[model samples]
Target: MAALDMLEREPDLAFSLNGLARALKVTPMALYTYFGSRDDLLQALTERLLSGFVTVVDGDMPAIRRVEAWCFAARRFFLGYPQLLGLLTWEGGNTSVAWFDRSVVLIEALQELGFKDAELSRAIIWIWTSVMGAISEEIRNRTAPHSLSPAQVESLDPRLHKPVRDMLMLAEQPDHFDSFFAYHVERLLDALRAIAKRP
Candidate 1:
C-alpha cells in the first residue's frame, strides 16, 4: 500500500522497481524475490486491480446492476490511483486474464440479448472506451479548488460547466450517480438489443 501510495503521488519517479523498493523501505533486491522487475510489478498491480473489481461485484447482483457497480468501483479505483492510467493506455505484454474475465460477464449479458461474439466484443470495447474516456477527463482536470467537490467543479468553471451539464443531461431524469450509470448502460444495452433483433 505504501509503495502504491508513493506511485500515486509521484508517477514519474515511481516507474522503476528500485524506486518502489526504496519507497516501501525494502532493499531493492528484496523486491526481486516477489517481482522480477518493474514490468512484473506493473503486471501484478493490473491483476490486483482487476481482482478487486471481481471482489466488489462478487456475481451477486443482476447483470446490469453488476456492470453499474463495476463501473462505480472502477471509477473510484482509478481516482485513488491515477498513475495506473498510464499503464492502462498500453497493450502490455503482461496483461492479466482476470481483467478479461470481468469483461466476459458483461459480454455474456450482451450475448443473452442475442449479440454474436463479434458484436459483443465491439460493444464491450465501446462501453469501456466511453467509461475510460470520462475517467481520464476527470483525472486530468481534477485541480478544482479544495472547496470544490466533483459536483461543484462544473459550477466553478463556465467552460467545464457546459460539458459536465451535457453529461448530466444524457443521464436519466432525476440525475444522480446511479441514474447516470444506468443511463449509459441502458444506451449500450439498447444498442445490443437492437442488433439482436436484426437478422
Candidate 2:
C-alpha cells in the first residue's frame, strides 16, 4: 500500500522496486518480505487497490446486478488511478499468474449467475479487456497529448469519418467518461446475459 502511494508520487515506481523501497525508507529486499518477489508486489499492489474500491457482491442479489455492480466499481477504480494504468500496461512485459485469481473471482461471480465454462472464459476476457481498454483510452486521450493532430482528426471525411472523429473527441471529455464506460459495461453484460440464457 505504501508502495502504491509512493507510485502515485513517483512514476518510476511502476518499474523500480528500489524506488518504492526507498520511498518507504526501507531496503529493496525488505519489500520482498511482504511480497515474495517484485512481480508479487505488483500483483499485491493491484489487488489492494481493487479490494479498496470494489465491494463484495451479496450472493442473494440478482446475478446480473452483481456483475454490473462489480464492473462499475472496477471501472471507477481504474479511472481514479493513473499509476495503476501504467503498471497494467507494464504487466504485459512479464508473465505473472498472481493476478489471474483476482480475475477468476470476476469470472466465477458470473458463473454463479449461470454462465457455463466457455462463456465464462469469454466473458472474463471480454470484461477485463474492454474496461481496461476504455479507461486507458480515456486516460491517454486526456492526460497525454493526442497523437493525432486536429488536422489529422479532421482529415478523415467520408461517411464514417465524422462518427470516428466524434467518438475520439468524446473519449477526451472528462464529463462523458462514465457514460462512455457505462455503455461498454452494459454491452458486455448483455453479452454475458445471452451466454447464460437457457437453451
Candidate 3:
C-alpha cells in the first residue's frame, strides 16, 4: 500500500490516511474504501511485516538454542524495519500473529523437555520479554535522534553505571564482541536452562 511504502522510505513520519492518500495520489476519503480507519490499516501493516517472521527453528539444535534462534529471528525482523515501531499494537513484539506462532515453537520445545503449565508460561514470558527488551532498546539506541557523540558514546567509565558501561563498551568497537545480539540472547538462554533444571 502507499502508506507502507511511505513508511519504508521515511519511518519517522507520522502515519495518516491523508498522508497515505497523498502518497498514492488519491483523495484522503478514498482510503476509507480500502481501510475503515487508522487502526485497520495499522493492523494490516503489522500482519504484512510479521508474515516474514521465521516460524520454525532447527530441530537438531538443543531446546535452549532453539529459543535463542527464534528470539533472534523476532529481533531481526522488527529491528530491520524500525519504522513500524509506532504502529505496533504492543510495546514489544507481542501484538502480531508472528508472535503467537513463534511463542508456540518455543513453548513446545520447552514442553518436550517436560515443562508445562506455570513453569512453561513463565519460561515463555521470560524468553520473549528478553528478546523484546533487547530489540526495543536497540531500536532506540541506534535510531533515536540526539544520539551521543563518538566521544560521548565511546568514552565510558565513571560517567555510566557499572553494568551499563560494561554492556556498551563493545558498541564503540563492534568487533570487540563477536555479536552483541547473540551474546545477550545466549546469556538469557543460559538462565533459561538453569530455570528449566529447577524442580
Clashing pairs in 2: none
- Candidate 2 wrong stretches, greater than 4 Å: 8-15, 33-50, 56-59, 85-105, 145-150, 168-174
lDDT of each: 0.62, 0.68, 0.67
Instruction: For model 1, give the 10-residue run with minimal summed lDDT.
Output: 140-149
- Residue pairs clashing, model 3: none
> Backbone clashes in each candidate structure, one number apiece?
0, 0, 0
Q: Which prediction has the highest lDDT against the true structure?
A: 2
Q: Name the better of 2 and 3 by lDDT.
A: 2
Question: Candidate 3 at residue 11, lDDT?
Answer: 72
lDDT of 1 by residue, 41-71 (tens): 6667667655545425555565555555656
RMSD of each: 6.6, 3.7, 4.6
Report the lDDT tens digits of candidate 2 across residue range 1-199: 6765775665433446677777789987888887777777777665665554654677687777777776776666665665565555344486334346445557667888786777767777778778778777867756674546667766766675777778768766767767877888888878777877767
TM value for model 1: 0.61
Worst-scoring 10-residue span by lDDT in model 3? 85-94
lDDT of 1: 0.62
Given candidate 3, what's the lDDT at residue 199? 87
